[model samples]
Target chain A: MYRLTGVTKRYRRGDETVDALSGVDLVIEGGSQLVIQGPAGGGKTTLLQMLGGLDRPTEGSVELDGTDLARLPEPRLTRIRSESIGFVFRTVNLIPALTALENVETALVPLGLAAAQRRQQAAEALESVGLAEHRDGLPGELSGGQRQRVAVARALVKRPKVLLADEPTGDLDEDARDEVMSLLEGLWRAHGLTFVVVTHDSAIARRAPRLATVRKGRVAVRERGPAR
Target chain B: MFFTYLRRELRCHAKAALAVALGLALGIGLVITVSSVASGMRQAQGRVLQSRYGLGTDLTVTKAATPPTRGSTPTFDFAGQSGSSARGDDLVTVQGSRSLDASVVSAVTGQSGVADAAGGLSLRVVKADRRFTQGQARQGGDATGVINGQHGFGGYGGVTAGQSGGGTAGQGGGSRFDADDYRAYGVDVSRPDIGPLTSARITSGTGFSAAQADGRVAVVDSGYARRNNLAVGRSFTVSGSTFKIIGVAAASADPAAEVYLPLHQAQALANATGKVSTVYVRATDAQHIGTARSAIQKNIPGTDVTTSAELAAAVSGSLTTAANLATNAGRWLSLAALAVAFLAAGLSTSSAVGRRVREFGTLRTLGWSSGRVVRQVMGEALVNALVGGALGIALGLAAAYAVSCVSPTLTAQVADAPGSGGLDQGGKAVGDVLHIALTAPVSAATLAVAVALAVGGGLVAGGCGGWRAARLRPADALRPADALRPAA
Candidate 1:
């Protein structure tokens, strides 16, 4: 479960101050899939970052599971991010230097899991995302769709409570986007984990259980979508 | 896992580490070689100095420069002086000339620290009035008996530099030779306790007997005998005194006295009895040398009192120049090398850290602390220093070997004068030839310092470079290298 009360974000560009998000509040229950749709520079990524606790809210409070994320210190915030949230960024965010299996295992290390258990869990996560055959393959060796699948596996390997995706389909072709979306939906349905995806794509908005349209640092409209 | 990351980065940037290692090797190698050579030369020179100055003579007491006094200066106006009987006190000392007088000699002999004392008047052969008449035909006097040549233990020939020429007549086949210039060394050969002739070696004929020393019997070096075309038992007639060549001992290159005689006879010969140019003193115990030195100096004011150590220091004047070069120039050069090494190491490590900013950022994201990051960087720098140190030591040894190859040893020239008791005045160095050795005096302490310098330098440089890298935030991982760096 997550809650946001009048979350506002501001950034400095040289001498000029720009509003990134302003006076926007939203809440979603656990095990629901929410998609935030907006044009470029429309505060969707900023809102997602605020929800993931990567960046603090400028003038509001963001709470997850009854704990305020903005008030927590950096170490505790880092602990929250490591244990509760998994990030899947836009460009198929897999470290080029590591294999798919290692990239998944990298997320498990903060959990204090031993090496053998981490390897087995990482292999299972890769299998769930249909990337078990590509476990030993590097990001450079994998196709765009396979790389995105690897990112999904890494994000879910820790079995975090919330999965944050920022324009997951932004850099992928139609076929790859379909594959990554289907994988996310299947994992969310099976594990009953919260999934928040931010994208400009209409197909992702139509597929999620809820859709919020953001414009000019505020959400213009909120509506219920088809079943997740 | 940390090393795995480090190893990957190292493989990606192998050239950087190599450059650092090479730079350090040059600096450390130079310091090791220079210090080893300088230290080795000092050890060799010490041995040579000990051997040059002979044994048993604990301390030497010589005449110091006379301090200027009112009316000490003498003016010889022939018209005013012709009628004035030449009083012994009237003879003023020569300018820049240092000689022992009767009072100084007697006072030195009476000192409590003096176990025994003997005097010698070192005289040079300034002029020769030869009467060489082939074989049996003697022009000036009768032919003296031929004394066969023999080898006797000879030491530094007392080459007295101040007096021109002086001596007394030998009571043999010839008459007395008298002149203020005709000279022979008068030593107290009668007393073996402090005699200058105690360490003397004769290469040709016999040494003087106790009776002969009181007489005008003389011992000459082989070189002197060859130069004068005289042999043992031949009559050397000079200043109308016939000195029968009682013996021909081995000669120094330059000798203060060609012949040895009794101390009293030499004082009698020089027309100045109870006076000597040099006196050899023996202490009752080795530990009393310093006491003897202080006593002699205190008793005889304006005298150069020298211990055996002082004599050794005086004999090693030339090496002092080499020592200065090794000390001032060698140390400065090593300092310069250290500076260059520090800069090279610092700059290279700084650059390496800058290039890996993103790598550090990723590690932080992976739950690694800033402390862990810093330690990794320092570890790499330490490894580089260790590699360089070993290479440097090897190179330094090679350098020493090369130096030894060029000149195995260089002769150290020491000149002993009659007045100073440097027994060998031939400019001959007495001990094992002075040479540079690779391991003569192993520079363990200096080597330790060299290693510490390298490691300490590397650690400082690494810490500096690492501090900037460790402070990097995880946000650094967001920017790709190309975006952060402008197109070259």
Candidate 2:
């Protein structure tokens, strides 16, 4: 469960100020899948970053499970990200130096898992995304779709309570995009994970149980649909 | 965990570690070499002073003051009696010329703190062949003719031809013979109370007996006999008097060079009567030197008095300037080693840090505090320094032992010198082995200094890397490293 009350994020660009998100108030219950749809500069990524405890909102509060992530110390927030939140980025998703399996194992490092168990869990996570055979391959050696799948595996390896994906299918072909979306949805449905996906893809938006379209710095529209 | 990290660091930068080790080794080597040499020289000076010259004594007074400039010999004026006049040279020139003055000597010897006393004489003499007219034939030759013929013959002989007489040619061609005149006054050699001649070594025959010491028998130096082609059991005539050579003693070719004979015989030979130049008083302890000096100054007046330590210091001080230059030269070389070590530590640490920026960044992001990162880097540096230092100490000690072994003079000097306990003395070979072992720990100090420099250098490198990493935003850090370009 997460809540944001009057959350505002701003950035200083030399002499000028830029508002990435402002006056945003929203809430999502536990075990819900939410899609944030917006074109470039719609502050979707900024909103997701703030919600994932990777960055703090400039004003108001973003709370997760009744704990205000905005007010937590940076170290504590990093620990929360490692323990409770997993992220899938559009580009630079997996650490290039590590194989798909090692990238997944990296996430479990913060969890204090023994090396053998971490490797086993990483393997299972890769298998879940149908990438078990390619687990030993590096990101540079994988296809665009395969790399995205590896990213998803790394995020899910820790079994985090919330999964945040920003343009997870941005770089993949349409067919590969569908397969990745299907895998994400299957994991969300089977594990009852809270999924917050930031994307401009209408097909992804249509598939989510709930959708919100962001314009400028505010949420302009919301829609509900069947989970399947 | 610390060691694991250090091992990884060293493995990653193997070349740099080797360079550092080599540099440190050189520093250690230099320190060991210089220290050993200085130690050896100091030891040598001490041994020469102690063994060859009975260096531990107070006042060595002679009738003549130390050469070139002479002091007034002490005069004795009996209270309520006439002043006594004795030839300065006659009184102390020969070993026992002043024996009859036992009444006056006993009066002075009875003084408090006197301990024990004796008198002797010293002189220089020339050894030449004695040519005689056995069957009433004309026989005559100058000192130079006799000296040249003796030298040309290469052995003692009765006569030879083409020998030139005394002149500059004589001075250049023949060796000058010198002798020591000594005497025991009213003292029995068998008496423990008598202060015996402490530093004499008789290579053959025996030292003077109380009775024989008063006779014309004399002990010549081994070098003196060898140079003069004289042998023990042979007789030689000096000043028309023949004296048999009874013993040959080892003699120091220093200021104390001389042949030993009874003072009475020496005085008679020199044709001086009732005269003595020196009075040797052996005190009970070193503390009595000053009291004896003051009493003698009061009773005899103007007598120069010195302690054994003072004598040793004075004698050693005369040679210390050269020794000090040698010691300082060694120290300067050691300083150069330190400089080289510093450079090596710096270059290696810098190269290592330059290659590990990414690892450092990972550590920072992994919640390893900045202080811990610095410590790990410094620990790696310390490990390198220690290895190099240990090797250097071994090398240095080995060198010292080798040098001592090759030179007996050096070994004796080291053995006899005060404050030479640290020197390797198990002969030359054992000393060489022990030198390396002993110097190893000392070389460790040099390594420690190098390690400290390396750690400091590492901190500087770490500080620069830390500043760069600290400036990056977390989002930037997590972004693709290539995409997260460094800020200009």
Scanning candidate 1 chain B in windows of ten residues, the lowest lDDT window is B169-178
Judged by TM-score, which candidate is best? Answer: 1
lDDT of 1 at A37: 88
Question: Per-residue lDDT of B1-488 in model 1, one digit per residue for the tens?
Answer: 44544564455456878788778888888888778777866655554443332236677666763444687544322222311322122222211234577566557768877777766565433332111111122233323333222222221112212211232212212111111232356666665445445545677778776676567667766766787788987876433455777777665422345566666666664455666676667787887887888888776777777676665555444455566577689889988997898788878887877877765654454444566678878878877777777777777778866766664444444444325332334533222223323232337897797789779767866877787777665543434433221111
If candidate 2 were superposed on the true structure by all CA atoms, what would the RMSD be?
Answer: 12.4
Please provide, for model 2 over B1-488, each residue's C-alpha lDDT reduced to its tens digit, 9 standing for 90 to 100: 45644675577467767777767767766777666665555554544554323433454332322222244332222122112222222222222122223233454466556776655444334332222221111234453433232222222322423334433222112222123232212112332223223454678877677777567676666776787676778876655666687877675423133455666666666554444344456666777877876776677643444445544454333234445655787788777776767665755565555555544533333333445556666677677766666666666667666755664331222111111112233322111111111111223454455455444443444444434444444444443333312222
TM-score of each: 0.60, 0.52
TM-score for chain B of all predictions: 0.52, 0.49
Q: Pick the candidate with the highest DockQ.
A: 2
lDDT score at residue B79, model 1, on the 0-100 scale: 28
Clashes of 1: 27
DockQ of predictions, in order shown: 0.14, 0.14
Q: What is the lDDT of residue B337 in candidate 2?
A: 73
